[model samples]
Target: MTLLSDQMPCRYVPILAIRPAEMKALEELPEVDKDSMLPLILIRPWLSANTLSKSINRFKEAYGETRPWLADIDPFYAAALANDDDDDDEADPKKVFSEIEALQDPANGYSNWCAFIEADPRAIPCLRLDPNNINALTQEIITFSAMQRGICLRIPRAGFGGIGQIADILNAQNVTSVLFILDFEQATMNELSNAAAAIGLINTIKGKIPGAEIAISATTFPDSFNGLKEQAIAERGFFSLIKAQLGQFRLIYSDRGSARAEKRTGGGGLPPPRVDYPSFKNWYFFKPEKIPTYQAAAKAAMTHKSWEPKMKIWGTQMIERTAKGDPYAIVSPVRSTATRINLHLHHQLYFDDPPLALQEIEDDWVD
Candidate 1:
């Protein structure tokens, strides 16, 4: 079986939150998009332990194949699960460390966490470098490295100082095939500073490991769309800057797939109807104030100058169906979110090399 590490050089790496909307979006992706990227899924704590035990099957069903992908648990969510806390407050850091350590324990035999790595032999385990949990994280690296398949070490932008320690760990374990993810969650590009920092970090990693595959990721996607009609995808610009300095194939481009980097803590009542349309540079958001219904929003998106009538992706089709007064399409906020994400994924895949003849077809009627 070919390991996910061996399948290097994928175009994009989207860090997706594991939810119905996100999963549905992934399930509906075209074959070309599926083949072009390797998604790193973060398992949230919405499901019961029983359901989570069958997660690998769920992933296979959504993906339509046993293709290799990366898997990691949301630390805060896992910590809450470990302590059986029902509130939305952040769990204790010690509990989070313990929970992560427990997941790596082989003495307990098979566990739901183990299912993430064991059920699908192709699933690459993701390890976060935490100073509070350094020992546990190190042991996790060793254990996952023992699997012979490469492991992904996720280093947040702030954690760059620990790259030397990570290099030592890899060297001590004699693990060569590794994917280093420089995660800059919620951070946006500000001129060339962020890009320069990232370039320096990439250089440091290369100097340390010399053979480490690297991916730079972040999200400028806002947590709330209120008072915002458009937003620039700073991560894209950041990737462009780094690619210009280091060459195109030096690192992978990654993002949060148009979702917020930090998960919302509490449920805010239902969001106003909105449709986020991705263009080459920005996300043009449509939210009608006079009539705040999904159908109205979909109609606005359909009539917008940026709407691509020739684009046959599932998300666009959903918008078209909803605009035509199809009650079954985009009935609720969750479905709307799914539709947006589905479109976003397709957009990212074709961002650099757009399909020929994909120009917008003129509509017969005016909005």
Candidate 2:
């Protein structure tokens, strides 16, 4: 029941927002890409009880197989919602409780996690080691570890100082095998100090929990592309630095699937018409200010050197169709997001491999 091993081709672990567009991207991923990566899906807080109920099923359907993956309710969102005293109907704490109950619950003695297990046994639950939640989380970890499915400890940048305490909790629960996700939400490696600090933390975690699998997760994707045309994929550079120092210590690569690390709040205006293409190191962004339409954006992207017509990727297919005036593929920010993410996933999975050729000949032909 090992989640990852030397024999597997698992290279990327994308931290995805559990939304329709992201789900569509996952659903459309090629089997080869799916085989090469694991997805750590974060359930956003805005979902209602009905949507929450459908999310796990959606995830299972999109994955198309009972493969190992991680699931966690957004801890920041959960904490904020739980502490909110406002009368906002959408931010109701009861709704948050229901959401928690559907995913993982400590209030009701992990009844929710048990039910979640019944729904998708392949899911590897993630726990955020918040001090306030540690007591409950310890019990949850014990329960999950007893199942022998493994547990993911999602440690935010701020949680590094508490590593000793976290190790004690794991030790007390007798949970030796674990997945540590060092999440740097909306943070980047623009500074050398940040990279050094991250490496140090990784070393500390490895020292505490020998042989534990670790993943470095972060995102530099901006919340708004305002007045911006391109952004470097800093997570790649950061991961590269860590890998250089660690050598072959089984550290997994993770990012936000080219989506913003921090969820944006408010703003009802339509998103700018843009299409983003991911290269080996940077994201080539296209936004047609004059035309202000997805068709124009797609057409503009086609002119970029990064756009490859021969690539059989789902995102490129959408862009090509839209550029050629396909109405079905043109319209809405949701479709645009899905297009970008699908491409990002493909690029990350095949970063070191050649592009998957589009099948043009019948395999049944006798030579």
Candidate 3:
């Protein structure tokens, strides 16, 4: 019943068409979405705000906590934001990890979005700092501190066409486990190659961090996932490239979809919604969950049972950074998913029809 096995403990599955303005939608999730144990979709900010943290908090407080967006599973992931990449002289992830912890001490409060639940059986509370203004040490320190506290860090490797500074943060953090996200909209043949080319990019720097598990995630595009398709069909030779060069069995971006993934419209909305390319239109790279047996049986209703996966795996070496910067991110105001931090969510749904026929039970069900 294992859909996939990778270094990271779970696969974060995202939902698509998440608007920044409508991020408050998180507050009204049904039982499933609110269940901290299940995977979640991130609704990012419409436009990168200078005060990203405050804006999101205000929205959530005004609305409500839609899902358990703030719970921690066995491992924790705290993501950070940065924009000035390819500067070469950036603080590492470890430094960023430290910086955030110091700021969140209740005395500093400089970490505009810093907050710790201070509860066990808790998923770490991630800080989505100001992408444009966050310091070099911000991400590095957060990663380091969170991991020391037994939390995994989820850092956005904003692929804005560069050998991003986030890599240094990733290297600096060097925790035992971490989650990395890339945007398909920003993904490029070069960035993917250069990123992997940077050794310890996939695995944490040696002697710096140990037992770190890496997972790559991306946002899906409107219609094409050809990059991933080639990788899956090819058994993802690019991932092999990372294992050979980067030396990690981590899940690459395409495995989760497009990292610099663009925005598209889903067909419906609300407690019951329909999406275009529903299967692959997730917004973020989420840890996957166990499907309920009944839910698994319900796959029959899916538009297409089979997907000719269009995923790409890129583990290339370093190169140039783009002018726009590669650190775009959006966090829902909700604290955590109902299923989080060591609490695995397994549910059952009944599908009357699926994208593929192999799952059909009886003709009556299909008709």
Q: Which candidate comes out best when scored by TM-score?
A: 2
Question: Which regions of candidate 3 deviate over 4 angstroms?
Answer: 1-8, 12-111, 116-123, 127-149, 152-185, 189-200, 203-207, 220-367
Please state the error at residue 155 of candidate 2 in Å.
Answer: 1.2
User: 2 or 3, which is superior by lDDT?
Assistant: 2
lDDT of 2: 0.73
**Tens-digit lDDT track of model 3 for 1-367:** 1111221343333322233323332233223323322232342322434333444364345234443332221111122323334445345433433433343333332333334333222233433433343463464346335534333334445433332454445455553443343322334444455444334444433334444434443322224322222222111233445556654444432332222234334755421111111222212112113532212212321223332222110000000011112221111111111111101111111111223212322212100
Name the lDDT value of residue 359 in candidate 2: 33
Summed over model 2, clashes come to: 0
lDDT of 2 by residue, 1-367 (tens): 5443431346788988777788888887776667668788877633454446566667777786657787777665676756767766576445445566355446644657655753666677776445567767676776777677777777777787887678777877777667788888787546422568887777887777786788888888777677877777888888887888878776788888888777678989887788887776778878988998889999988998877667766777788889988888857888888888888887776665644434332322110
lDDT of 1 by residue, 236-301 (tens): 888888888887557788887887777678876888878777765688788999998888888888
lDDT of each: 0.73, 0.73, 0.30
Candidate 1 positional error at 184, Å: 0.6
